[model samples]
Target: MSKGVIVGIDIGSTKICAVAGIMDEVGKVKILDIVEEPTQRGRVSNGTVVNLEFTAKDIDRILNVLSDKAEINIHNVIVNISGENVEGKAHQSFLTRDDSRSTIRKEEIERLAVDIRKSFRPTAGNIIIHTFPQEFIVDRAHVPDNPIGRFGITLGGNFFLISTPNDPHLALRRTIESVGVKVQNNHRFVPLKIVHTLFTPLADAMAVLSEIDKKLGVAVVNIGGDTTEIAIFQESGLRHISVIPFAGKSITNDLVKAFQILPDHAEKLKLIMGAIPPDEVGKNDIIKIPGVEGLPDKEIVAQNVSIIIEERVKEIASMVMAEIMHSGYDGQLISGVVLTGGTSNIAMIKEVFTKVTNGMNIRVGNTIRNIGQTAVAKIADPKYATVVGLVLSGFMPLDERVPEEVIWGDIPESQVSIGSYNNGFDTPNSKLNGKKEEPPQEEEQSGGGIFGWFKKKVSSAGKIDMGDDKNYTN
Candidate 1:
């Protein structure tokens, strides 16, 4: 009967959105309210911060609205980071005991993770954010997902590590902190997979699928303004995740180029005249829009506009299909593709998706869960899935295993010394020791175990609430 509220924020190049909700005893979230606002032009690019100040202000406004609507105190949030630079690479790590009599234990698993993290850095200044345990093996024998109790001399784990540019992580933390909210300890490392799989998943799972098709492999494509994120679901965990650079903004750019119009005007026209089927557009359907200076107000054919935009949309669809093929998911997705995001609202988007996916059954996903069937049908837009997914993930028991540590260093170009902080803070410091010295502890992380001291705190609380202080719950 007890409930606690948490917030989820997603900062993208085109828009910033926040959702607040309460988690029930079983760790299910009931969304309270969601707030969204557009990013000022040029403030953010491809999930990276181009203007910290403006981005902070925009996020501040959205948070304020969400807080008021939800009627809850907001301090920490689970944020989403997706872009070209945010990449997921698979790697395998093995831990060998010095003594043959030694057996593999959870501590050994933690050590192996620490070792894997060491080799994660790229020459281009990237910082590790999320880690996925693909599989674990003991004594050269494949083991099930759980290996804590098994006895073995060697512990091996296959991991998919996701990282982003150090600079973006730093800048985003600075912006979020400037808005007077503390980010979670594992803010950067929290995986979106956890959110999608745990909360509102049935809907996302059903986006392009029917109940009968659940057993068949299916992929969900979220084509947003800044990033196109893909998720493939098998029987259990997600098989693959990728962030592509192509999305709605590319179509907007195409409109600007082909129409010889200002970027803003082009975006507006595309929204009004945007449609997937060129045949549906009438030749006489002309929209009057302001033309460039020295030219009269122009009358443009809506069909011509549709053709140009559809061409780009088709290309994006093709790229996603290509990715699915390359992922070796061919004939794997029985349910076909589920398309969601703000860009999914484009006129005739479902038709386009259906055509591109060919034999696969496709449907627009709606983020309606726990709500009644009627409301689910009314709010059936795909654009809000991420925000809803954020709320869904927000409600799950927080992975208190890792306290917020400063993964990215000080923000460059600013003269601010920024105070003593750790991995919880995303932005880099402008000055250190008044000499710009690197923090010594960056190389030596505290909380030696993967589920460190912070996890112990949460686990202890759970035990007390269960009226059994002698037993710890994870």
Candidate 2:
């Protein structure tokens, strides 16, 4: 068995959280430490870094806390990115073999994926983040999940391509690099890598979605502090993904504006009072809202709080339902909608979602199913789903032909130049130069393909192991 420590950073509009954990030879993850701090206002918005310098400082603080607690010098990390500018589109490509009798090879499948990626022309300020295959068609007669080694004269593939604005993408990388964390690599472009940037919803799906759920059709709704991300899966592939510029923070803002209360007080009321049903609250029940400075404590009816929360929660749910319908898989979600993220913790969220979707199966999603270890118990909340998934994605095996689906844009050679290095952080001469290297060539596997690399790493001797029972401070 082999083991190694990996760090995952989740940068959100409301908070910055860093998680370090150990992955065993068999892919079980044990949390070593988790550290988080409130993101300064204006530093991040809708999961995008708005203020580069302040965001960098926040990341540095979070990394320092994690490093101090884990008692390790962190060098590299997998980070997540999301925002309103992030979007997903459906695309397909076809390839024909010269000989009709020849069996389809993995390389040919990969070439088809490359063709699909090249066909996409992202807007000037945007770049493709991921391109995941939905299914493969061989010889116009058979449709298989994996077409490698199949006999065919022609092969075709349907893919889901995800893209994000370049400004936010570059800002996120710059912030991480400013903290001395390395964010450059092109190691085979495998889906399962310890250090790379990935879409937040995709990472969340990796951690929480099962193969059964994907095959049966399901939508993962991640409600973050500033955004609600939706990813729909069907036939064991990603079908649609989107970001709604509203979430828990939006609810808090509503409360603040409605009650004229401080943001902190509004948040406390939202969490403590809970989004209870209005009818459940007693007519006489009243909650006290602590006053600030010279202001006197204000008393409001519990029913009123419930009403305020219910309205916003319902609105968010309706928006999610709309996105699902737009995905064209409205009635195909056999597994229903799975709600996750910090906001999913809101009282009655599932109930609200069920009502909005007209009684579709609804449930709250957490990391308990995939994560093991008592240390992670405290962080097993829905809020940590994205970061937890980021860590878990490092251990999940990559599909054979999917490696070619990793579409990193043409990075300028100028960005490849490494500038001065100090304090474990290397400052790039320019932020725009963070280009990914070309994937290395490897012999295609007859059956296992690139997945064999994972098995070899897991079973290999002399694996790097984090020592036992080291000092870790809370």
Candidate 3:
């Protein structure tokens, strides 16, 4: 209520990242901390908490570590949920009256969205995570980005429904609740949507498709650890989205298969070899790889490594390009392709992308603004986009823009009052909600690292004490 510090959690397969920041009176968000913890299995299949208990424990550990470092609470943080199954489809719905000439009001349009979502409810125990209103059409005329007040006989809207399996949803909810923290939101949105929101200046599906040179329609390719998300934009709105089930991990896996090495060694070799041309690598160039259990150490040809990686990268890029071409954009993404995510960090990836895509416009994406110069020099390292976007997304207050009165989905008919949970708010704690407390002495001492000076200033308030008194479990 007092413009509290905001936190963003991006739970990915490879790692769970937590970024916390506070906005000053002037409205600039200063990132306080960024922390990552490797998942026990290194990735969550299809974004579900397959191993719910293990995943929850890992999340708790990361939250504890970050809370200490940032000296902030993660209990009420804004988290982003993304995965292959999470999808967005544009649906057009309208309020039609048997008799024409009935003037439409803002409430009518609000109800229109609610009605649309209600129509698509799953018969099973699944949940719609997010309902995004894309644009409004009033009669024959187009309305503003979010049309609510315009008067018209018929109101139409383009909405996106994001859903997930009910079990995973329950697990995510129960896990966070178990840690004494409420799930602020489960934005069943995708990584690309977050990227578009955080970095509006870049080539968003709508921006590239509608605003950019027609010849250069853009393919926003986001390469993550286990999956690569490809979205095609032509003439401004999203045309298509496809998820390839291979990415950095695939390349890492390829190295293992070809060299008969362990994943760790293969991953290191993949990152070090970078993306190079198969032909450029000489056959005699050998690299030593550690021996596997019961096997002698091996010597592999660098050419073989290059050939293997190039083949995989080319195949993946081709799949993405095929998605773009299938979208039937007016021309090739003359603007070329804008890449982002961890896989984009592979050295010479841009070159490989160009070769694979027949030389379209290609470059890596970043949050050029928001991040400080010093942090930019360090954090601008592309792989941090989603985590950075998670932090930045908190700064944009979506609820403030929408009316507070309209309900977006069907209300459950539970015997107990669920009003407190209706509007994305938490219920006040009572004895029934027994809470736990963490020790104050475990809070990270601030003055020893990059943020040492900040720790000194905040702690110097002489009001600083061990944060063990907080209502959270260890």
The model with the greatest lDDT is 2
Candidate 3: list runs displaced more than 4 Å: 1-3, 96-106, 121-125, 144-149, 180-219, 232-239, 275-284, 326-336, 370-377, 397-474
Residue clash pairs of candidate 2: 415-433
TM-scores, in order shown? 0.70, 0.81, 0.71
Residue 257, model 3: lDDT of 78
Candidate 2 local accuracy as lDDT? 0.71
lDDT of each: 0.58, 0.71, 0.55
Model 1: how far is 183 from its true place, Å?
A: 17
Question: Tens digit of lDDT per residue, candidate 3, span 334-399?
Answer: 677877766787666777788877778788865555543222344565666666655655554322
lDDT of 1 by residue, 258-377 (tens): 877888888887777664456678888987878677788877778878987888788778767766775667678877777887777787777776788786777667566433222123
TM-score of 1: 0.70
Q: Pick the candidate with the highest TM-score.
A: 2
Identify the superior model by TM-score, candidate 1 or candidate 2: 2
